[model samples]
Structures are given as C-alpha cells and as structure tokens.
Target: MLRSIATFLCLRCQPVTALPLNLRSRATHSVAENQQTVEALYDLSVDIQKVRKLKGWVLLQSPAYTKEVAELLKNMGASGPIIAHILTSHPEAVLCNPEQIYTQKELWISVCPNQRELVGIIEKFPASFFTSSSHHDNQRNNISYFQSLNLNKRVITKLMASAPQSFSRPVEHNELMVHTLQQAYQELGGEEANMKIWLQKLLSQNPFVLLKPPEVLKENFLFLRDKGFSTPQLLHLLSRLKGFVTELNPDSMRRTLLYSQDTIGCSETELRDIILRCPALLYYPESTLAERFEGLLSAGISMCQITETPTVLELTTQIVNYRIQRLKARGYDIRTGSLEVLNGTKKDFEMSFGKLQLRRERPLFNPVAPLKADD
Candidate 1:
C-alpha cells in the first residue's frame, strides 16, 4: 500500500500533459471494473494533484466529476487541515454533484501560496470519504470569509506608517523641500549632473509658480513699456532677456521701475540713465517708404509704378487703382457697374481736354508770340 501510494504521489508530480494514456486507461479500467464510486475516487485524486500543481482550476459540470476528484484526494491521504486550507483558497473548486466547478475556457487563477496549501490538503484526505455534493457554494464563500477579523488602531497605525512619504508631509512643505533640493543640486556645479531631475522634481512639486507664455509675454511687455521703452525696443529687450528670467516675479522690482517711468513722469536725466543702463532697451529703425513699397510688392500687388515726378491726375488714378486692387485681393465684392462709372469719368475728362484744346486752337483776337521775320 505504501509503494502504491508512493507511485501515485510520484505520478501526481508528472506533468499532466505527459501522463501516459495507458496509465490513465488502467486507472479508468480499475474504477470501471470496481464501481462508479471507485472510479470517481481515482479521478478525484488525479485532479487534486493537478490543482495542487497550480496547473489550473477544474470546472465540475456534474456531481460525478466532483465526487470522483474528492475521492481521489482522499485516497492520496490528504489531511483535513490541508483540505480546509485548499477549500478556503479555492472555494470554487468544490462543486455539487450536478454542477461543474470550472469551464474549459475559464482561467484557473490561484496565487502561489494558495496553491501550496491546496496541494498539502490533497495529500491528507481519505479516498472513500470523498463525495460529490451541492455544498460547493458554501465552500466558495468560506475562502474570503475569515471570522473574528478586526480593524484596530494598531493596524491603522501600521498602515499609515507604510504609506507613501509624500502623504506624510504638508503639500506646501513638500514643495519647499523639492525646491530646496533642486537649488542645492543646481549649485553643486556640474553642467550635465542630474539638473533635469532636480528641476523637474522642483517644478512638479510646486506647479503654481509656472507662468503661461502669454502671461509671461504680457508681463514682459508691461515691464519694458513701463521703463520708457518703445514697442520695437521692448520686443528687442524681450527677445534678448527671455533666457535669463527663470522664475516669474509677481512683484518684480524691474516691473516697478518700468511702471514708474511710464506712469510717473521721470526726469529726463533719470530716463536717459535708465535707458543707458538697460542694454536690452536698444531700438531698431522704423520702416522706410521704400520698405513699405517692397512690402506692397511682396503682398502680391503687381502693375505698380513709381516716378520722381507727380501729377494730380496720375496720382489720383494710381490711388484709385491701388485701392481697387487691394479690395479685390481681400475678397471684396466689386461690381463691374462701378468700373463702368470710372470709365465714363475718364472719357468725360478726355472730352473736356479736347474741348480745352479746341478753345486754345481757335484764333484769339490778338494772339501774342514771337513776331514773324516779315513783320
């Protein structure tokens, strides 16, 4: 009996897929030859070993399958204590004789410690005592149903102690600590040394200090404009000084200095001194007429002509044409009827010119000019 048990135990250790069909056939033959009870017990032992190995949970569709698996465990000499643990961990494994415990597709999810407990349980039960029944639901409930569980202050204290470090500190204090750490690392002196780490940690810890680009720009514009600076100069100053200003200063001294110059009329000497001291206040030249002309060309205005001499009629016509072209390019709805009016005006001017010429051609009463040689 000892050798038979040892062999069965050894067989249990064998990979389930590697189990010889012949051995299975023999086991099946033994049960069938004996009775349904024996066969059920034999099959149960095999399944329990499989479950113990953590291969997967089995779904018992019928009472016979459950009883057979239980009986097999019993035959293997599985103990009550071990069985209790296994049943606790895998309550779903227990099934009524008419019900199945696992399905072919369902995963047999069991943790490692639970699996060990299950295996130990199977080796202590008696083969004959194992039976299929409808008590599986009760067994399933028993797994997580630990009686007399308590939640004491000590347990709560232990849980709090194990929590994340950030949870222990005031949020603002945490931010200060991060900022201090960053400033420390930055001061430590290597250009490539973990600067990003310290900086990011600092920023993330206190994100309130970060300013949006528009706000920064607006502040900058206000700053420079307040300092008696022109728009072009302010833009130039902003471009040059952007790299140095790392932190946003809501109460910036520089901003105050700027506001004083703009709002409070500073003495000429003070203003000059301020401009001289601030190198970023330097200005660029204004756009020239030539530049404006080039801009017009760049904007797709064609058929333009400019000359040193200017005539009222020519200038007026040029202005009108320029306005019309600009309006058309900008998607304005110009009517041909208006253009006809312009043509009619031009024709009238032509006719007026012809009449004036005809009047001049008409002989005056005493036309004065260089006397003819005959006179």
Candidate 2:
C-alpha cells in the first residue's frame, strides 16, 4: 500500500485553493497515474525543485497556471528577486487573471510616464503589483485621498516620492492618522495654522508620519520638549529634521549632546540656545561637529559670532581652510563671521572687496538730427 502523503508534507503544504472533490477523486488511480501526476508537478514549476528530494510530496495543482504567471511577469519585464519575491509571498498570484496584471501595469504607467521612472518605482515598491486588481486599485486610490484633503498634486507627488510605501496604505486609515495628529495639536493649545504647518512638515520631513501611532508622535514631541525646545523651535525641528528626532535613538542624541557640551565647554542652556537657533547641528555627526567650532575658536572667533550665523558650522573644510589661511597669511583676523568667505560666489566675493562689474551701453543716435537741423 502507498504510504500516507501526510508523512512527508509540511503544514504549509496544505491546499490553499483546492480543486473540487470530484476532480481529485477522478485524478486518483493506480501507482502509474499517481507517479505521472507527481512527475508532472515537479516537471511544471521551476521553483518547485525541492519535490525531487521529497519522498512523496507533490503539488496539488497543475503548474500550468504558475508557468503562465511567470511568462506574464517576464513579458512585462519583471526581473530577478522581484519575481521570486512576488511568487513566494503570494502564490495566488499565479492564479490571477493576466488582465489584472495588465490593468495594474497600465494604471502605474499612466501616473509615471517615463519607463525608467516606473522601473524605479517598481524597484522601490516591488510588492505593489503582487495582489488582486481590487486591492491594487485601493492602494492606487491613496493619492486621490490626499487630493481630497485639498492637498495639491505636487504635495501628493512629493509624498509618494518620499515614501512609496505610503501609497500602499488605505486612504481612510491614513486620514484617521492625520486626524489624530491634528487633534493632538489642538489638544496641546495649537492653532489651526499650526496644524497646517505641521502637515507640511509631515509631508516633507517624514512622509511616514501618518503611519506612526499617535502615541509615538506624542512621545517624540514630549522628548523634544524635555530637551528645552520652545513651541516654535519644536515646530522648526519637526519641520527641518524629523528623522533625526524620531528615527534616531534617544541614547545617541543624548551622547551627542553630552559630547558637544564637553568638547565646547558650554553650559546646557548655551547648547540649547545654539540648537534652537540651528537645529541642523543636533543632527550632524558628533565626530566632526567640533572641528568647525574648534577651528573657529583657534582663529579667535567667539561664541557670539557663531550664535549670530550658525550656518558657518555647515561650511565645507575647503572654504573654512581658505578663509582661515587667507586671514592668517595676510595678517588679519576674522572681525565678525566668515559669511562672505564661506558662502559668497566669486563675483560676490570680489564685490565684497569693493570691486564692481563695469557696464557699457550704445550711445544714442542724437547727432544725425542735430546735423540736419544745422544744414
């Protein structure tokens, strides 16, 4: 007698979409028919090679449909890991009607006209196409949902660009997330304008902001609050650098803060003030953050000058070196800040030294009328 098929099978080997009882009964027969059926299963699917090693495991359905799916993917130019990922994640995709895949492709192509751009979108969001047409349309409709909020098309594009996964979420779910964010702001005594500005920050600095639970956002806000940001400075940090505050580990932020204080020999209040003025410093690498500050200190630059133009810290090493060397070699010290030396264009730099662009224009044709009048 034939050994039980269950003896060699895994739990996941169960039929997800089994054929009818009568079909299974009719297909069963002597050892010859069973052997042929098992061979056919292995022969049909390329990803099903492990069956060769199995004692009695077999594919429940004919691989004809799966082969068709693979061919359809190849015809549509799907490559390598993307194809394997789709098949592995959603085996039902093999049973999907070709028209469904075609329609989905057309939908994305309409929005992303350039072939290369579509490829990039697909690479970033490869799982986007591995679902039923209805599900695909639901995710595609997310952009429309953003539009319904009175957001411009450009904002929608930017949202998708920043986080393509955002498109995969349901519209109502994201709207609810946004609503929670707005309610949180209102509860905190923020104005209507505050909500609008916050929404802009969410769209740019963290497109996935809407995906996070409301509590997480609240926690991050509170953490930033503990760090001594006023309401305005908090808004600015959220607007300019969401990832630094939310995505970065709190311990790392604390270490960076501590390192900066120890290196610069500044008080906590002074560091807070500097960060409030230029939040970018909070996100910069701890290792190199001191170079600009230390170099400026050696050049006799003061804290007041840095406080006035904090962007000086962001200047390139080349610009800082040139400015410092130029100053030292020429026997002059930086009186204020190195704003012009670090940032100005060549023409602007020359103009800062009192040099100006000369101008010329054609002379008027006044002499011809005067000559006629004299004659």
Misplaced by over 4 Å in model 2 are: 1-102, 105-138, 170-173, 187-190, 210-214, 242-244, 291-304, 315-336, 340-375
Give per-candidate clash totals: 26, 0
Q: lDDT of all predictions, in order shown? A: 0.36, 0.58
After superposition on all CA atoms, what RMSD does each candidate show versus the true structure? 30.6, 12.6
Tens digits of per-residue lDDT for model 1, 185-277: 343342435455434433333332222233443554455456466655543443334322234343554544454345325564565444434
lDDT of 1 at 120: 48
Show the colliding residue pairs in model 2: none
TM-score of each: 0.16, 0.53
Error of 1 at 245 (Å): 4.7
